[model samples]
Target: MAKITASVYTSHVPAIGAAIDLGKTQEPYWQPLFAGYDFSKEWEKAQKPDVVFLVFNDHATAFSLDMIPTFAIGTAAEYQPADEGWGPRPVPAVHGHPALAAHIAQSVIQDDFDLTIVNKMDVDHGLTVPLSLMFGQPPQSDYRWPCKVIPFAVNVVQYPVPSGNRCFQLGKAIRKAIESFDEDLNVQIWGTGGMSHQLQGPRAGLINKEWDNRFLDRLIAEPAELAKVPHIEYVREAGSEGIELVMWLIARGAMADVAGGPAPKVVYRFFHVPASNTAVGHLILENQPA
Candidate 1:
């Protein structure tokens, strides 16, 4: 059986990508936004996991508001770049780990979590921003990106989204799916989104840095406890429709052991207030060696 090595969390704010491209990372405001990643960049380079199972939500890019699946897995060979109104963020297309993804699909089925498999689709800033932050645009030629990916997109945009506990359960199930894989490959699961701030109407530009930092501190050391926070509270206090942090529970749940213990610590954490309509909270957690 393959061993699961690391799990990382990232906030995908498209503006951050623009900041990096425009060399604004050194600016006082933008500097702190990317500052938390200093250690994460090094950790990823060292671990060099074979596959990254990214847990992110689609921003009405692939699955329109018409129909949305609570949880969707990409089993395709490749994913295209999505055009988020302005234009496509010129970057190499994302490559998928089909073998591992197929294994996850089967395992998840056996575990009784209904999933929608996407063979062909495009991903927006939700997935690419993190890719650019961590891996940059894929390198030239046939080989690109430091590792392959299995994108597990959660739908958090529409109402009636999955609950925090439900997302956490999915994460636990995902770990089982990965561990049961016959192949001997190193894997990392990433949960993206949230720290507070709303994108719509009057609630826009809301910043709750204090709450964001507190959430980060707890997420690393006591995720199981964090997972218990109710969804209604997330939306109410975090901001209307800002309850998307629940998706992070899925990433946190994947780190929990069957015997039940504290998950891992945040080896690297970055927080940038006011990334467009949201606060960018990026974190990376890896299981401590036994």
Candidate 2:
């Protein structure tokens, strides 16, 4: 049966993607931020998974004010990069695992978590930026992401977004769904976005390094307790966009400890500030072999 071998968490900032694409990563301002991920890229190369179940929020790219699903899963064979006001990034198209995705949708919905199954949609930096960070840029001759991806988008833009507790529970259901699948595949669940930075009004460019680090510590040692954090705290303490941190619970929920399996090994952990207007955080946790 399919298994979730690991879970990755990171911030998906569009400027980071642009820096990499523009070959500006070596610049003094951006060097440290990219340097922090050097270990993650090497670690990912050493232990690659067949598919990545990426969890992120749509920054008003796919869903607008007119339509918003609290949770959506992509079951399409392919997804294209979106043009979010600025031109689209020159990234490889994302290949999706339709069979596995469809199965997950069915199982998750049966588990009572309502999800909108999307067959076609343009993926924004919220999705693509994370892939770029992990897999790096594909060769110019053949541009394609290294592994199949199943995009799971949460509605963080809307006011009544899913709570941290709800996201955590849903992640457990996802873990159950993956284990019940018949295929024997290696999978990684990635939670992207937020370390704490707000990008709006007078509060723009706010960074709470202390709060972000504390969050990382709790997320590593006591996610169950951390999952209890309410949305208002994330907004008031971390900043408005900081509410995006709730998505991390979904990936953390799929970890081994939450499933009564072995404790997860923290393979890699990183935190950096001022990646664009957001604080960047990255983690790689692998399930200890049973």
**lDDT for every model?**
0.79, 0.91
Q: For candidate 2, lDDT tens digit of each residue in 84-115?
A: 99888899889999999999999999999999
TM-score of each: 0.92, 0.98
Candidate 1 residue pairs in backbone clash: none
Lowest summed lDDT across 10 adjacent residues in model 2 is found at 39-48
- Backbone clashes in model 2: 0
lDDT score for candidate 2 against the true structure: 0.91
Question: Whose TM-score is greatest here?
Answer: 2
**Tens-digit lDDT track for model 1 on 1-290?**
76667777777777887787577888987776676676677677788889889888898889998889889999998888789897787777788999889989999888999999888889888888887777654556744678888888998888888877788888888998888888889888888877686767776667777877888887776667877787776765677645768878887788845327455655776777676677878877767655
**Where in model 1 is the C-alpha error above 4 Å?**
138-143, 256-263
Q: Show where candidate 2 strays beyond 4 Å.
A: none
Number of colliding residue pairs in model 1: 0
